[model samples]
Target: MNSKVVEEIKIKGGRVLTLVEGDITERNVDGIVNPANSYLQHGGGVAGTIVRKGGRIIQEESDKIGFVQVGSSAITSSGILPCKAIIHTVGPRMGEGYEDEKLSKAINSCLELGLRKGFKSMSIPAISSGIFGFPKDRCAKILVNETISFLKNLENSSTGIKLVEFCILGKDTLQAFQYEFEKSKPQS
Candidate 1:
């Protein structure tokens, strides 16, 4: 409802900033991205959630990718979601230890692709931090920096994303992001 890029989707019995879950499409953004694995076939993790809520097409199109390697971003029509498009990004798994650069590239590349595909708005989950195993605090800090950097570059542009939201999954993750945004210092 608020055209605000960052919003607090309040819910009862939760931390003030904890319930930051809202429909990415309701933001009326050009797109919302999923931090998906290479398979595109939704199994569990954020991919599972997006697949369940966003629609089956999320999996269908993702499956079409065959095997998306890490650090690359891809685009697909929102077969069932309200948003105009879906950007699936393959973030590096944590076990390999390339979190920083790979995560950065994934986020940056997703935005770049969104812009290139003619999208003016986008919503994203915290990439690599959940199932991908990126440390929550560190990932939150990096994500905040990356988003602010993206906004700084898009200061006065139309194709640039006017709204860049971090659709966190739970209270702890939400708090981490809030800490990062408020103090410019991520919570450990």
Candidate 2:
């Protein structure tokens, strides 16, 4: 599968946010965010792909961490994958109350985890937009907004994060993210 970078923008603090049409498991970054279940299972979707490529050690570590609350995140070794670690975040399933808030919190949780780990870069998928059933357009807006908010709020001491890529799989989703990103870009 060819990974196409649809858009890239420089945000505050010299960090770059990119929208890429690709598999998140294939990204070469300091960490990759997995749109995971609260139980941290690696059975399907992006979770399955990450486990298959990064090896069983990722699952093994997840087994130890056990359950994560919706909107919270956990970290695990990435095994043989290109990235150093995988950040697993639990997002709300549709029909659940407060889906928007939960989705925003999930994205923020991933960014907070990356910053705390002092990671230089990370890649994230559209959390909750898959089996969790979050609307793609809403997901794009929440993800991009939360990411930009996080970057803008960062202190000089938390400057390690320099790049964030939204690695989307489908064309529609990629366009959704790209459009939101473009709208959110700082006006020169």
Candidate 3:
């Protein structure tokens, strides 16, 4: 429950939220967010990794949400991904209007949902930049900004989330998040 200012940061990212190349099931964040399709079923991408590692229970729980429109959110158990919970978020597809803003909204909403549900740490991937189509750099910047914004606004949020990390998997995705994170770090 350390106090953190709602201020901008200048970061040198030696790490980031793992993306396509990172191991999704090995993370131990209080919760991990998933960029899921409306159906929540696993497929040939990040979603697939989740299902493969976490198990069918992940998709089954997600099915309870029905169909979450793009930019909206839901939450469920991680099944078997090593994370305690999974925040299922649906983001805008490529060329969707206001995609970046919607992506930020989706990302923040997922975190907010996790926090409200009593999680103290959250791990999120680069939203909307993969199959959804938003540019990786743009999504990373907005994702970090929106995450910071939410942290700043949450009352008594200190212990609520001591660590909010991005889990990037691919080299390009990793570089994108790291670059934006470093750019956003507060100058010492």
Query: How many backbone collisions does model 1 have?
Result: 0
Model 1 regions lying over 4 Å from their true place: 1-19, 23-27, 156-158, 185-188
| Prediction 2 global C-alpha lDDT | 0.91
Cα RMSD (Å) between model 1 and the true structure? 6.8
- lDDT per model, in order? 0.70, 0.91, 0.72
With a 3 Å backbone cut-off (N, CA, C), the pairs that clash in candidate 2 are none
- Candidate 3 lDDT over 14-118, as tens digits, reads 222222335555677788888888777768577788888888888887777778877778888888676788888888888758877778778878877887888
CA shift of 88, model 3, Å: 0.5
- Residue 18 in candidate 2 has what lDDT? 89
The clash count for each model shown is: 0, 0, 20
- Give the winner by TM-score: 2
Q: How far does residue 171 in candidate 1 sit from its true spot (Å)?
A: 0.8
Q: How high is each candidate's TM-score?
A: 0.80, 0.96, 0.84
Model 2 C-alpha RMSD to native: 1.3
Model 3 misplaced regions, further than 4 Å: 1-21
Rate residue 98 of model 1 by lDDT.
72
Q: What is the per-residue lDDT of model 1 for residues 1-188, given as tens digits with 9 covering 90 to 100?
A: 23333344221222112114554444456788888888877688766766776778777877777887787889877766668888888888887977798888888889889878877667788888878888888888777777667666765554445556776656677778877777642235
Per-residue error (Å), model 1, residue 54: 3.4
Candidate 3 Cα lDDT to native: 0.72
